[model samples]
Target: MDPLYDRLARELRECIVTGVYGAGERLPGVRTLSRTRGVSVATVLAAYRRLEDDVLIEARPRSGYYVRNRPTKAIPAPARSAPAAQPSPVTGQELVLSLVKASNDPAVVQFGAAVPDPSFLPVRTVERALARAARQHRNRAAAYAFPPGLPELRRQIARRMSAYGCATGADDVVITNGCQEALVLALRAVTRPGDVVAIESPTFYGLLQALDSLQLEALEIPTDPVDGLSLEALQLALERWPVRACIATPNFSNPLGYCMSESRKRRLLTLLGARGVPLIEDDIYGDLGFGPRRPPPCLALSEGTGAEVLYCASFSKTLSPGLRVGWLVPGHHQARVEYLKYVLNMASPTVPQLALADVLHSGGYERHLRTVRSDYARAVGRMIEAVTRHFPAGTRITQPAGGFVVWVELAPQVDSLRLAQLARAEGVSIAPGPIFSATQKYRNFMRLSCACPWHSDVETALARLGTLTANLSIG
Candidate 1:
């Protein structure tokens, strides 16, 4: 399909979704639209067909296309999440453990964990790369890859990061077990026990676990469903508290999935830079954006501004999660993170680094991203549509631009934890909202994974989950 048609289709979709064309309203004739938009008849037809495939519009034998009645049109977006206004010690989540256990059971529909299905990853490509690396680095395969990891792997990471607009070198990159360790290292490098770290409300539960282990305090800020972290609330928090670091997933964050705009990123840097607080960027989901260009990290937008941005990312989402190769660009805290990486685990495994570097250098990684990005985008849409149609009329959900998870806000009367237990009894698993917070603020919301391939089993599971949710709302 021509890129032009895709752009036109997107514009037409915005129109239908925004109610420019009301339910069942007819759209302009193909030729008329083609002339008005200054495009060929083929382009118009292609655009209309795209919307048709998305169920946004439909065609009649003799009439022009018409907008389909949208189930989500009347439902407002999820209310912005508001965690505690004060910083407090992080706490463990038992529901997270239960969700993880259910996620591993094949009999259960897997919507608990926010990980992509293995089928959507570059399994074969990485396996081949691993074989080649083992054959080539037979001696080094048994060795420990000391701090900062292999120069070759670091260099590959540095080069890939350059495209994201960060000025990095092999010395600036530090490899860890995965993004989990990267976050722990970044937190330890900049913060101490009882120090405050401002974060998004309804954040990734893994982050809460990291803070809990480090004995750090969390200052949760209200986050918008569309624009991401609210700078106003963060600035206020910084003024009131002695925040040591601010951790954020500015690009396609988990659960919420809002990608902060470039302007917001710049302003955030200036705000934190003024206060001398480091911004620990968890960009694990940065590469999974549905847009044409990969979303740049906060470090990229902070260049020349003299802001402190510690960027962390991993190949686990795009490649094999078990491979466990993640790198961090610690702008000024590079030395601290390196030392901690050595102390925490001595060193990351040698062969996986070499294997990942091989896959990246071969140009297969980017090709793999192109396929998986589309798959995630399509899956997310299907999940949102399903929730919108079958769930309660007032149920709200995030419309993520990227990533494969959707955060749902159910009716206030419903207890999400109870809903999860009910769903589990029917062989369906879901991550209830309370698990996402250290303070456990969102009792009625839940985050659902859309990374699974859409099938009858998955469809049936979501519908059944919706029925259960409705049952709870009634009682």
Candidate 2:
């Protein structure tokens, strides 16, 4: 028994998903849809708005709505992860460095880094914004910005945060160099050296590196590829060890694209509050959700519950990463995080902050996001199809709901590091799974980037990767 609006929305969503309306094809006007479907104009409009919120449709001023390009075939998502449950010392720095160096080489087809292709970014729009910012505020651009960052940028971030269900004002937001610095400040705010922190198994390599640099112990928790962190496992770890803090990307996690359920988020917040531990949430990829609404973060659910969730995010994933503009909502630990940020580097670059602020204020950022979301979804779909066609029979992959990376698990006989080396020699780059874990598990796993548009070169590289995997398996 869905409501009238819900029913209408669902029906129309199915039509869009099933290609009843193809990409860039216009849908029936409000009046026409109302008459044809025997529903009120208001109902049709509501349904359209729901679709727009999901990034499934776009409304033109007088031209009606159009179908957004999205993945048609549903790739089966990866299964729940099972990593060693004990706390272990972080390693693999050399491997990470080597992989990063290789992934950055222009000679290779990059399926290793989790970065979006430059073509996917709004370069012209951003350049125009930057020029305007420099001309309008020459003095401001030249001066050094202090820790809390530009007021206009913070205000814009606060406005965007409300859309994601986190209620906060400009005064509560602290800008940093990027999400990386925000995460570092958050880690410093909550944990001491040698303290144990619980993290998702097969988590982002960058997080593992951060833990290693800060001399912290990692307790890997089993995580599902679709549902995100295993709350049951987290509770068990909390009971067994003296976990000082926890970090996770609850909405569209990196490597393994998954968003945690809202119910589970509430329960996790409650559990952390009861244990008097803080949770550092990385929401950099939250805006890329391919669904109707952005998944709410843990901080939104923990409001007024006395549970601390240090929220970190950036425009790098959705906008220009080169600008290095990001922010942190430090919950109750705002003062400490602000201080750490001040001591860490004084402040982020002023020119880029001003440029980004102008972009956000002019409403250009949102428009750009809509375009890229569609592009990324289409690219991911193509990657999934290519993988299915070329990989071995037992290959399993993650069909991410959002974000631009896919995790693939091959037969146990294939070693990812060796495969990575072979792929590198063939001018194809990939992120081996062993680097993602402190224990160097997932020897047969690798993460591939789906940020680039489909092209013959990418297709050829994927086929070669599959061949390399098969050859290694035989060896």
| Model 1 Cα RMSD, 1 decimal | 5.4
What are the lDDT figures for the candidates, one per model? 0.87, 0.86
TM-score, candidate 2, is 0.86
Q: Judge candidate 2 at residue 232 and give its lDDT.
A: 94
- Tens-place lDDT per residue, model 2, 152-252, is 99999999888878888998999998898889899999999999999998899989988998999999999999888898999999999999999999988
| Model 1 per-residue lDDT tens digits across residues 95-120 | 67777777678898999897678878
Candidate 1's C-alpha runs over 4 A off are 1-74
Instruction: Give, for candidate 1, the lowest lDDT window spanning 10 residues.
Output: 68-77
- The segments of candidate 2 whose C-alpha lies over 4 angstroms from its true place after superposition are 1-16, 21-76
Q: What is the TM-score of each candidate against the true structure?
A: 0.87, 0.86
